[model samples]
Target: MKKLLKRIKALIRKIFQQFSSTLEPSPPPSYHSPETWIPPIPPVPSFAPQWENGLVLVCSQCTVEQFAGSSHRINRSITATEELQNWLKSRLKFDGLWGKYRVISTSCLGICPQSRVVVVLRNHLVGQQCLLVDPQSDREILYSYIKQMNQ
Candidate 1:
């Protein structure tokens, strides 16, 4: 009984030592200068339109994941499609034309492939319109389309 008790105690100690080693906290790094620290800017809230005229570009979910890629590759959790939508919204907001146009992120619009991001520009006056775009599309083309839609 004495030998058995000794063995059990030794086993328990060994197990605790292994567990404690894993729980050990990492050492703190050497102190760095305050200059080395840079505060991150907080995200701006979504812009709310005052009037609503020009057109709304709906970015579908199908394109969201493909454009965003893995979290490691993309800095913002926002996908490529979302980035485009936000850019449009910001442009309208900064220009104080929030009443003139709006860009919205929408769910899967049934269109997949064609490279991740799909945009549908709808103008009340001109009627509904759709444009399928991929990540590889030229920026100029997108701008031109927007310009034409506004006209």
Candidate 2:
């Protein structure tokens, strides 16, 4: 009886060893770093922007609360910003100020108005001016201001 129990225990131990070895996880794969990781030059050209003096940055992340009867809950800033950009582009080309200024839609510029979009005008002569503009009613005013600043 003792020899039989010992043989059974040894058989169970052998089976457990085989099962555990099959279930054991494999070793992790090795990694090698590339030798030519850094490039010799920048990927793109480094030419300066065509804008001569004025740079207008319009915030594209702002939002205004909608009126009580509107279906949408809020108004997005990009719609207003793009509208203003198109308006300015057409007018600037007509006035021959297209090369003198550039309008870019940018992320939040740190000055966040609850009901308006923030616009930053960087000019060589007048310096920097930050304006809170309502796109629906302030496009002409903003354009006039930009013209004033460039002058």
Candidate 3:
């Protein structure tokens, strides 16, 4: 039993040594070559809403700054903009109203007090109107509003 255990330990050590010796150090990643460093694909351009089209949701004064005990406290600062963009994309897709309107994600709409975000609907009839939306507001409300404006 002792011999067998010794042999197994010896074999394991040999195997590890062989593996370590044979392993070639990986070269540092090169960023100079475009082929080697693939840039992420840009987001698809949002469909322009037909005349009197879609709503634009903006996140104004979005930063690491947070109000105490507010819902925005846990929100990630960097992706706030991306989150708004993606939200518009998903809302448009889920509502089955993708091509019918435009959903824009614009920077700082100048309404800083309204939590972390502000939504605006721009169409021929409504011109430009600001919407005060709760973080939990149903996206369908915006869609329904747009539909009504179209009629």
Candidate 4:
């Protein structure tokens, strides 16, 4: 019994020694002070945005809500999202205009009310007009809304 206890104590001491060695802190680099350090700032280029204008953020996971404060099951949001993208592409007809505007699906837009949600922004600048659309309900209406923004 004494032999077993002694062996266990020795093992515990060795384990603790290994752990303490790992816990020892290392000193920081020899930088001394930040007052002497100078940061590099690149010069601004004379250029504008590669794309023409605006952004379109579509919620790919729009769902229909039966009641308030309940988790929603995803409906035809993917189809509606694809429909909107195709419609926008066909209507725009500008080469690479579709690429300029984002046509991607999102998890949820937080407004689940028996319809798909699509958000459109004319410009990313401050105070731009952002439109929230329901593509499940008359996509033509949504198209017209975007068309107005294009003009």
Candidate 1 residue runs with Cα over 4 Å from true position: 1-52, 65-76, 135-137
Worst 10 residues of 2 by lDDT: 30-39
The C-alpha lDDT values of all candidates are 0.66, 0.78, 0.61, 0.58
For all predicted structures, in order, the TM-scores are 0.51, 0.58, 0.47, 0.54
How well is each residue in 80-124 modelled by candidate 4, as lDDT tens digits? 566776666666566435644544456666765465464645554
- CA deviation > 4 Å runs, candidate 2: 1-49, 64-78
Clashing pairs in model 2, backbone N/Cα/C closer than 3 A:
none
TM-score for candidate 2 = 0.58
Q: How many residue pairs clash in each candidate?
A: 1, 0, 2, 1
lDDT by residue (1-151, candidate 1, tens digit) is 9999999999999999999999986544447555574455899889755434556656557555564564555455656676677776676677666666767777877776556466777766777777776544544476566656555
User: How many angstroms is residue 33 displaced in model 4 relative to the true structure, after the best TM-score fit?
Assistant: 10
Ranking by lDDT: 2, 1, 3, 4
Model 3 stretches astray by more than 4 angstroms = 1-52, 60-85, 114-116
TM-score (C-alpha, index-matched) for candidate 1: 0.51
The C-alpha local distance difference test score for the whole of candidate 1 amounts to: 0.66
Query: Which candidate, 3 or 4, has the higher lDDT?
Result: 3
The worst-scoring run of ten residues by lDDT in candidate 3 lies at 60-69
Residue 63 alpha-carbon offset, candidate 2, angstroms: 3.1
Alpha carbon lDDT at 23, candidate 2:
98
Q: What digit string (tens of lDDT, one per residue) describes model 3 on residues 12-99?
A: 9999999998896655467556447655688987864463464565564443223434764563554554555566667767867666
Among all windows of 10 consecutive residues in model 4, the one with the lowest summed lDDT is 61-70
Query: Which predicted model would earn the best lDDT?
Result: 2
